[model samples]
Target: MANNQTLIPVAEPVIGDKELAYVTECLKTGWISSLGKYVTTFENRFADYCNTQYGVATFNGTVALHLLAAALNLGPGDEIIMPSLTFVATANAIQYTGATPVFVDSEYGSWNIDPAVVEAAITPRTKAIIAVHLYGHPADMDPLREIAQAHNLLLLEDAAEAHGACYKGQRVGGLSDAAIFSFYGNKIMTTGEGGIIITNDQALSERAFFLENQGRYSDNPYWHPEVAFNYRMTNIQAAVGVAQLERIADLITIRQRNAAYYNQRLAEIDGLTLPPNQDWAENVYWMYSVLLDDTLPLNRDELRQKLRAANIDTRPFFYPVHQLPMYDTKQSLPVAEDLSRRGINLPSGATLTIAQVDYVCDELIKILT
Candidate 1:
């Protein structure tokens, strides 16, 4: 989607020469399937980058989450806590394990899962906390970790959107018991479509790898030990991942740069709230998200429509999981609901030039002011 098209896209991948060369190598060697050198290399590279000990590559992030859930043996009578404001996949992954997803409200400062609310939600059956690094800002993990320790519960990160984002001084994927990341086409980095489980826990890492590969041992390929999934990432995908990882720093820097420019320009719009940049967190600004306060003449959807007319694409924040049909618990989470109503993701992608951003800002100013 990141191309020189007429419409400025909300997000796009930045593919380069290295990606093509690596992919070509996979094709030339007939190692297009999951069995190839790129898979292990990519896994090790990503794990090292995250300061973690292991990485189990998967076809996508959702399965990586489900894989972890299975490895942990979560099932009925267990509950997992997470913010209501995140994408529904977080809740679905828990549901896949037959575990209930206990929803919590978001904190105003980071628009992330609230630690105080998480503590309150814990019960005898509560098994873990899935702290999502929303939009690119890390959740305040220290308090959450404390609560988890106090309750004897595991803490995990759903860092699909916050690759390279830092909490305090550490990167997100290495901050918990285990974390997962999405390498989707529109993410900060891309492998076309892929994901991985990163962690320092030897037992959990071994379990995840075992479960992802149909639960069969290499020495006994003919014997099926347990029912599992074929969640392996393709060699081609890992090849792309390796190339993307090679220049991950540059991608992160560009996002932060774009965010800074957006902040300087769009900050002029009085009621538009800038994305969070905490003193202890390094936000990668994946989407350059902003919230539309009542002071603006147009609501979020209306402004999005006008931006559409101007050939600029944008995305509204996700509806809280509790509000969605599958998980409609009738539980009132005021902060998550409010942020979902007001937040919007602007054109934050590799293909978006400074000139395109200027056009977006000009259009917003003309329409809102």
Candidate 2:
């Protein structure tokens, strides 16, 4: 066994020689700022990879969401429906546009926003639905698309955790009207801190570009037409992102292999529920999250404590957004509430070795048994 003091983290970005070379070139060329060829190159390449027509690079994922909201012209009295079992950024992005975020429960099977509940949550004030691909599994998009079309509601995808995931043979980023991706240090891919908005609509793409770059109708200096944001991604970040994108397939394979190793070893254990992979979905396993059944001898937090003592880092799932103090609502979402209390994310970085995965599963089995 590795030393007990050698902590295995829940996630880590894989930075290699190509990333170093790219960033070093950026530094040597003094193109480290927001304006450079690397930024445009990375945007085009990433958008193409996701089968989108255009990409608008941003300072970070949250800002990308905010940019999308701005492009859609969401404002006061408007509503955007989203799952409560998600990172706070999803809700926060909607609120940024002066729109109210309506919380919906997650489905237990996929841990994504429930389409049935989504329809029920919509009111006359609803203008959009943010379908978050939680934990790298694509949400049931076909039904959501149908609902969006029927109601004339815009369907936007929060694909931050689902870089290479697919549903019904289409990539997550292309399944909706538009999508946003995060390149945070711990994501499947990394740019230190950057994000991009992808869309097939040309007008929406142009609008996002205009909004992110201070609302300049043209690149000409000192000509602002409307209120906008300074949410541009730095060239240094894009350099890293380009290198990361080059190896995205390999990185995803490594994560999936590690997850498989854990699944095989941990399957026999009782009181543990493995992450779900629906028949129509290709899960990228952003983090190999599992739920501890309520009947387990130890609860999720208790298990996390045991793992921590053994130098194994684990993370609890997000607290349902509706329950958070800032957006506190009396709405009771049973599935999201139950899953939040029991779910835990294991060590699932792309660079994690089979032996390391075995160690984590062994430690978890020991704690549960």
The number of the candidate with the highest TM-score is: 2
Estimate candidate 1's RMSD in Å: 1.7
Clashes of 1: 0
| Predicted candidate 1 versus true structure: per-residue lDDT over 246-316, tens digit per residue | 99998888778888888888878889999999998999888889999998788999999988987888999
What C-alpha lDDT does candidate 1 achieve relative to the native structure?
A: 0.92
User: What lDDT tens digits, residue by residue, belong to model 2 across residues 1-369?
Assistant: 454668999898899999999999999999989999999999999999999999999989999999999999998999999999999999998898899999999998799999988899889999999999999988999899999999999999999999999998888999889999999999999999999999999999999999998888665857987889999999999999999999999999999998888889999899889998999999999989999998889888888899999999999999999999999998999999999999999999997888888888788878887
- Misplaced by over 4 Å in model 1 are 1-5
Question: Which whole-number lDDT from 0 to 100 does residue 5 have in model 1?
Answer: 46
